[model samples]
Target: MTRPVRRTRRALQVAGAVGAALLALSACSSSSGSSGSGSSATSDSSKSSSPKVSGTVTVFAAASLKESFTSLGKEFEKQHPGTKATFNFGGSDTLAASITGGAPADVFAAASPKTMAIVTDKKDAATTPITFVRNQLEIATLPGNPDKVSSLKDLTKSGLKVVLCDKTVPCGAAAQKALDASHLRLTPVSYEQDVKSALTKVELKEADAAVVYRTDVKAAGDKVEGVEFPESAKAINDYPIALLKNAPNAAAAKAFIELVTSAEGQKVLSRAGFLKP
Candidate 1:
């Protein structure tokens, strides 16, 4: 071949090699991009399916949460190996006070938003408090409802011994609102510090009846009878929960909160007689 012909053939060979190289690079890039996308999707799926959380999470919750929360704590521990859950249950206001007083708790679950407000107002909550459940008041009477207390007005019956939660607590506040709505005046034998205590009085026959939470009555089982009153609708308490600002186990606390708000958690609360928020 002549020199010109040989030069044209060499140019064509070089162009083909460059084109092959470019195509090879493009293929590699496409493969890399696809792999990265798949990896990211897998990572996200894994994260959502089995979140990684491990630590000791301390939760301060209302007295009514004692049973359901205790069960959730055990489930949390089981789901996250190397993690543990500890709970402090009491009156909502008292628990809020403890949290605001610098208690090293990871989470706070109150029976009423009013109680949770104390923490949020003090900037002790990591985020806005969210209502997880609601509760209504019920007249807890002796087994068989011996006194036949059917309504809030029945509690005002002459000479009937009754107990009530102190007005500061959520149950008490609800009870007072209910009574006020019914335009009824009830004179209780005594005022207990919490719903459980008030229910305990009736369970022990210390009083004929007590205005307490419906959940408390259910928890008391056959020991007490629950009398649903119409006025209770006007005084339902919204139970709020949140992670503390200074949580010692932030990750675990978040996980616990998620579990509590999950369908499974709601089921447990419903079984305990708590209404969903």
Candidate 2:
């Protein structure tokens, strides 16, 4: 199993992950749900007009989205009394691989369109993936800026012990884009498989800094300090979500997606530092 998958496998809930209930409703004829333009959710068939949702809604989301997604899941549960929202948070690439490998996920929310494409290209998605939110890269340093690191280039200094997400993942790819945009190079002590692991290294003081999503830095609170750079504009990652073609619980999955794209969901994501799509 991929490192991210293993981290949450033991706690995985059944019924796969969450997705668009509306898509399932329009399963036979619907072009409205095929194009993800502007991040607008397709018609909400899981609303009050629809029947109450039951069973579990499994959600496979990116690690950086953990905080906000978790909150939204709880709210989803509260809104639909007997339904449970189970999640498997990890690197977008790993999650995509798992889905394509037949992990039986109902919903997938990836950190980047590239990762989402992995599943879409395989026809694993029931409908076109919708870009829900965007995230920018930020430098995460120990609290109080102990290393006096103020810029992306500063991470290049000798002996800084900076850490980074593996280049195969979204955060790593964005960091690389920012680095290339600034014409700067950094040699991190190690490359983590997910944004959470990279941030954890700095939180534990095992590394001095890491390049991760702004949401991650904010979630860390006092554990780390966030430093924004001008080049991050060149590498913002768009998060996209979709219902799986083989969703075990299509009804609840659609309701979960509806909840994610709802106004309330946007508020939760905004507070977590995600950019408006």
| lDDT at residue 118 of model 1 (Cα atoms) | 93
After TM-score superposition, the amount by which residue 225's alpha carbon in candidate 1 deviates from its true location, in angstroms, is: 1.0
Candidate 1 Cα outliers beyond 4 Å, as residue runs: 1-51
Model 2 collision count? 8
RMSD of each: 5.3, 25.1
lDDT (Cα atoms) of all candidates against the true structure: 0.91, 0.91
Summarize candidate 1's per-residue lDDT along 218-247 as a digit string, tens digits: 888999888998889999999999999999
What's the lDDT for residue 157 in model 1? 89
Ten contiguous residues with the weakest lDDT in model 2: 10-19
Model 1 TM-score is 0.82
